[model samples]
Target: MRDNTRPLSPHLQVYRPQITSILSILHRMTGVTLALAALLLTYWLASAAYGPEAFGRAQVLLESWFGRLVLFGFTFSLFYHMCNGIRHLGWDMLWGFDMPRLRITGAIVVITSLSLTVLSWLMAYGHVGKL
Candidate 1:
């Protein structure tokens, strides 16, 4: 009698990612970054409520080029995570099960996420609005 309590599954390190797997990992990473970004936003808001001095420092930090870049990345991550989450929910309902549909939807998720992110920042910075 063989004891199969430990199934002969391949180790994670042995497995190379296909496109879907890579996108799945990116989804989780973006979600985590979005969460941290939310917390940072809350901290900045609280600083604003604290006093003028607190608000001034927060504003200075936010105005810094590096800080603005970080915020921009966070904004993009937020949208990317949301788009990917919707894709996962669709899959949960047994949608996009075909290989072609999966690939197309995956591409759409990535492309729209990037496009929307850029568009959002452009609008926020008060430059381009349409397209």
Candidate 2:
């Protein structure tokens, strides 16, 4: 009998990654990160439901430097995921199929994600200064 098993496809080391691929991978990773962040949000809500003391401790934790870092990560992941999701929708609609358009949209997603993340943090910190 002849062996009919198909060989596996080439691995990632075979070729350099493109912007589109990087963005696609990041989109998936950010989704996972967002799920973790949701757990954190749930902890906060549960603390509130527990009592004043629990809520105060939770607030203190959330206001700490480590907590701030986690919040920033969560915020960036959310914005990146949202922007990439929109890009995926565009592709579903048969848009941005060409290399140039793909690159442009990839760049746009990165910039928009970063810009929105920064703007959101600024607003959160009340540093937006009357605007």
lDDT digits (tens) for residues 1-131 of candidate 2: 86668656545567689787778779989999999999999999999999999999998998899999999999999999999899899999999899999999889989999999999988877863665
**Which tens-of-lDDT digit does each residue in 11-118 have in candidate 1?**
545778777877887887898888889888998999989999998999899879988998888978988888988998999999997989888988998999999989
> Top model by lDDT, which number?
2
Model 1, runs deviating above 4 Å: 1-12, 127-131
Q: Native-vs-model 1 lDDT?
A: 0.86
How many pairs of residues collide in model 1?
0
